[model samples]
Target: MTLTTPEAPAGLPAPTTPGRGRGRSRRAGRADTRLPRARARRPLLFWPVTAAVTAFVLAFVAPFLVIVTNAFKTSADYRNNGPLSWPEEWNWDILADVWERVGFTQKLVNSVQISLGVVLIAVVLALFNAYALGIGRVRWRNAFLVFFLAVNVLPQEGMVYPVYYVFREVGLYDTKLGYTLLIGVVYSAFGTYLLTSVFAGFPRELLEAAALDGASRWTTLWRIVLPMSWPTLSVMCVFFFVWSWNEFLMPLVLLISGENQTVPLGLSVLQGQYSSDPTAMSAAALLGVVPMIAFFLVFQRTLTRGISAGAVK
Candidate 1:
């Protein structure tokens, strides 16, 4: 006899296979979830970071704008209107008057000479010092590095007397070469500390290859290390230049002659023992700041490349 099959209830449909429909359903669910997540990520992190950076830019730029506007204003207008107001007239004469009175051309030359000298000497000294301590693996180098760091922490104020006495006794007093050498060597302590850490992390493979090729330490340093580390060296030069250019107390103490006074020292003359000129002082500030701005603009590409190169390798 033939057997008969069971049938579904009248209103119900048949059940589906487990793997086939379930896999397609899971994929559809994933696609739906990802659409919402991608939409969520579209606004995340970017807007907040952009807003913070914009605020910082404005904070720095606003002061410079105020300075420029005030630099263009006449004494009468500035006195009447206040620092925040726009200039009534753009007076180039104020700048010329300040320039002549300050002997800014002479001061500019002094600053350039001192700053460049400091950078050159400091970079060479730091480079050699770090090479020995870091790559050479000199005896007790860690101890030496620690000592250098401790020296850096010593306040410049405390060392003033000893340095002044030495300079006087050495007959380097009131000369450009005197303080240029002094500041350069003093600043090299920090550079040595910084470069030691960098050199310590240098690739041992490259160093070993140089050694295997019978390259002397000096040859290796000049041919391989120096060229590779040029970015870092450039950064160090920039720092040293800026530091020397802005040096005030040291120059004031060491450079007694009026002709030898740097930008900062010369600008201080405007304060005077008896009287002050506000418009001229503003103009002086503009003159002092312009060189630094120009220097930064010229080196901006170098700085960006240096930082990125450092980050990458």
Candidate 2:
């Protein structure tokens, strides 16, 4: 009696025991209904996503394509046809002509000078300011941060009058030197705000360890923090460079001399009041964007790595 297995009631016909086949059939039936719904639901999601991505891609790429196609086209071809149509013959002379007419070499040099100057000044200022606010945890740091945010909030339009007046007074109104300093300081506001957040999240244990080793704060910063944050700083530098490079309104207002003008200002030569050269304009546009695009492509991997490495830290 103690060893006896439990038995079902006879009248219940042994509880109508089902074999693996019956259970398998039930599961298969459930899967049949579920799988079809899942399969049907997939296309519903996939198609919309594909369509949206395609729309966005075309929206962005279509203009670039137009620029590139028109860049190599002859004036007659561009005028006879349109921007979207392929060029009948590739007139490579447009680039050389546009280059010489606009003094592109000088303009590009000006752009590089301004961009590099801005990057160095802005990144350094941002790093130091971020360190003080984020790592040092200075008094009223939040207030200081708010001030930086406020600076960024003021649109260029609002500051233009005052800036123009001040620069005029200083006799820097039409100089590359003035533009570099002005744009660098202006761009640093955002960089300070961005780097502050990154610095605030820096590992405390590392700081403590450095202190234990008798490394001064300044020493620790360069020797340790700087390297750790190099990826982030590199990313920020790229942003500042691109921002200052593409600066239009400020350059337009300040740089009156053709020799002093940055790359963006050179685009003016492509257009005229009475008539504009569409092909030449396209060529200039193509040339203008090439450097920045190349810069971004080079740093794209660093940005991705910085973000991923940051998550772990």
Candidate 2 residue-wise lDDT, 21-88, digit = tens: 69988999998989988888999999999999999999999999999999999988988898889989
User: Candidate 1, residue 36: CA error in Å?
Assistant: 4.8
* TM-score for all models, in order of appearance: 0.87, 0.85
Candidate 1 residue-wise lDDT, 104-210, digit = tens: 99999999999999999999999999999989999999898988898789888887889899988999989999899989988898889988988999899999999
Q: Rate the local accuracy (lDDT) of all candidates.
A: 0.89, 0.89
- Total residue pair clashes for candidate 1: 0
Write down the TM-score for model 1: 0.87
Candidate 2 segments exceeding 4 Å error: 1-40, 309-313
User: Which pairs, if any, clash in model 1?
Assistant: none
Candidate 1 weakest lDDT stretch, 10 residues: 2-11
Each model's backbone clash number = 0, 0
